[model samples]
Target chain A: MSVENLAISFGSNQVLKSVNLELHAGETLGVIGPNGAGKTVMLNIMTGILKPDGGRLVFLGRDILKEGVVERVRMGLGRTFQIPRSFRNMTAYENSLVGAVFGSGLTERAAGARARDILDMIGLSGKKLEPAGKLGLLDRKRLEIGVALATGPRALLLDEAAGGLTESEVAEILGIVRKVKESGVGVIWIEHVLQTMLHGTDRVMLLAEGRDVICGRPRDVMSSREVEEAYLGAGVGARTRRKRA
Target chain B: MGARTSGIRQIGGAPGPRGGWAARKPLVLAAAVVVLALLPLYASDYGISVGILIFLYMSLGQMWNLLAGYSGLVSLGQQAFVGIGGYTLAMVTQAYHMSIALSFFIAAGVSLAFALVISFPIFKMSGVYFTVGTWIVSEALLVFFRNWAFVKYDAGYNITVAYRISMPALYLGALAVGLGATALVYFILRSRMGLALMAIRDDESAAEARGVRLYRTKLACFLISSVYTGITGVVLYLNITYVKPGAAFGIDWTVCMVFIVVIGGLGTIEGPVIGAVIYVILRQYTYNFPGISMIMLGVAAVAIIMLAPEGIMGAVHGRFGFRLFSTERRPPPGTGPRQYPEDAADV
Candidate 1:
């Protein structure tokens, strides 16, 4: 599932206005923005977690907004929140089990088996039975991705999965994202970590004030002047600061 | 026991609390059920009636646990449904002369339909609004039942029965209902729906952000709890053969459910079972005293909430990190990728 020409708002605050983007099979698109700039909102709109005030969301050329989040998940559209979401008291294995059993239509025993496999993929196989709340930030993020992956998604939307991680942790997360891409899952990753996102993503989009400032190749978009003024925080934005000199 | 011994015993046994609650609990519950199962057969008629009341409260507690505990609905007005169920049973059995056993199903269906309609409005509210809205709605129900003409308002209604049901029969009936209620809560918590409910409890908005259908999930839980509780009300009326507006619509029903789950473990599968047992015994023993029983209960509940905020099951969890029924993952010692194999697991 993918999005095109989407628009959304929260109350009077316009979160996203006429945003255009697409994600194909096994490709990655990076959405970069500062805090509260509506990166998450755009992802939410795309995944049908939130409804748009205007515009079209076509998943497989069918209108996706007509369906609910759980149905969309069943149709292979999965999302991860910026803060990891799990059943706190449940084992990490059980948290993923919800995705497998209900979202994937697997039986109870099958869901348990599937949860263990997902735990392994995210490098959390040994801790399948640990309560999710007790996990540290890094493991929590991994479980979030594992939950999305556990549903056997064709498209995975991640909201800041690598935030608050050290350099090595960031590299490991990048490896997981790449591995996901390699497995033929369409990926849309929203992150503030420009360096890592640049390294992991094939295409980069600059998001500012709910709309994309620029969208194209990682190098081309990052070097664009409008992107620098809004995001990328590249020398174009810094050059404006130097112009004050 | 020291913390280290608990640690060693846990590892030497199961790796975690996975099979812990499963093994010994049902055996203990079976023993308790056996005792309760036999009490009414040996005791006098009034004793059997008291046994029925125990079943009533136990079933209510189990139903409440599904909504307030497992689903995190935190309702305090289950009494509303109790009145609805009782009055509906009385109306059916008195006017229509429906079979007493079938009245239970009738009352449940009516109350569940009403609950679904009620959920349409209440499900939109969150936090305090949700809690207070239910209380007010229940109070409205109390007023309506009090003034309703056919049911005799505050005075109550009388039902017609073909014969005086035997003491052993009532006891067995209540026991059956209580056990069924507990098992239903257990199996549901052990399934897919249970995970979604606990997710609502942990962080509702985050759950929504991750594709959980907040309103539908909550509404489903509300209807299920209300229907089972409605059945409990009908059972209470069956044993007593009468129900007054104040008695049927009072806060006692909610109090019993809350007391049981709060003391037992709130969200754990075994929490309500343990809580129901403790509550029944405490009520039975304390009723022997005059006024002090209420004070004792109030003090104990307050003290437990303060000293053990997690309740009985939570305390167990704090000490051993055991989850009786959950599938969330915790990271082990290092960054060794401790996730479950999303494909298969012994869990």
Candidate 2:
């Protein structure tokens, strides 16, 4: 998947300006940025939830901007929201089954098998019958990923999948991402958790003011001067401080 | 796991803790239908009249439940279809000189077409706007019919044939329509579209992102619901043999539907059945009160909404963990807990 020259504005407030990125098969790409940096906005545009002012989103060489949300899912582009949006009234098993049945367009029998497999893989096997609204935050986050995976996507865009998790829980999430990688599915993960961006991802892209400031190995991007200025304001950067003195 | 999946072809195949009742539901349903079919023989004329009203309200409540509970389209103008249904039967049978049997189909088609037409505008609005949009559409139609010479300029058309049909035949027709509407909802919910509707109801953006076609699924639901509401209208007007614009397009019809669904259960299949029965009984009992009855019913509805927001069936399901008409697929034995939380049982 590749995005080129993506731009969108909400009135006078330009959310994204000419952003671009690419994802290869079997790779995990982490997107890190400060608040209002358009990370989620970009993901929403990619998933066809929001239309960009100008951009070319090519998935497997097919421009997907014209397609709607469901068509994009069927075309193997799946996403999970930052906030857990599981069908609260449905059981965890049934929730996953929805994605398998509709997202993958699998026959009912095949979808049932796939849903079972997804529930087992996500470690929700014990609480398969539990209503999603009743699940704990950790379990809900896991189920979010499980539901997205049930779509049978070639590339999955996760918006803050581990937004509110303990250290160990984040590791468990990362472990699931490893399994996703092993299955040869590319992932574009956005996270505020630095540890997840540093360790779980193959590469990290630091976004600020709706543009990619730097893209490289996780440590390199984290240590870059641009990232510090982006996060802490330009006055806090070493070079800016020296010039001020 | 294999055993559970093997029965996937059945609607409620997975064996839950309440397996005995769940498994025997079909047989019980058949027996109940047999009893209802035999009601005319032993019951008085008034009893049969009440029965017919219960069925009509049942059909209307189920259709409304399908639109609001399942698909998240909270319509306040289902009377538009009801009125259309009633008026179509009148116009087709009396004005057009069409056969009564053919009028039933025409009424359904007309309402279905109306649903399709209004969908283009109403579908654009969501949440409260969608609800108000529906009410406005029905009101507009009401005004249009009132002035239109074709519909006798608001005086309404009377179906003379309604007198020709016996009470038994009318009761049978009402029974068929009631069961048919319930069966339609049951089958839809048991199919893949059922999942989509519930998913949409839970969260539209998430459902759409997960590959559920939002508009198409909603349109299908609206059309099905409208057609059934129209057909029920035919039976409804047949009972009265008199149809006026005020009576046919009255907000009271929509009020009855809302009251029935709310009193019984909002989303569950069994909710409407219980609600319709309760509503008919309550209406019959309150008939003597005349002036105070509307206020009394309002108080009752408020009490139910406050005490049990999920309604009677919801409270019952929460306590009993069983459904007479199950549309859910539970986990296999030992895979999960025997009993789920209230929400899981809601399906």
Top candidate by lDDT: 2
Kindly list the per-residue Cα lDDT of model 1 for residues B1-347, writing each as its tens digit.
Answer: 69999888878875454465667766866788788888965788767776776676778888888888766788878898888878877888777877777888888888888898788788888778988889888988889988888777688778656236766876787888888887887677655676677777777765654456778788888998899888888777777687788888898879888999898887776677667777877777789887899888888788878887888878987897665444343332333333332232221
Worst 10 residues of 2 chain B by lDDT: B338-347
The lDDT values for all models are 0.77, 0.88
Candidate 2, residues A56-160, lDDT tens digits: the string is 999989899989888899988989999999999888999999988898888777677677777777789888888898999999999999899888888989999
DockQ for model 2 equals: 0.39
All candidates' chain B TM-scores are: 0.81, 0.90
Alpha carbon lDDT at A201, candidate 1: 94
Point to the candidate with the largest TM-score: 2
Clashes of 1: 40
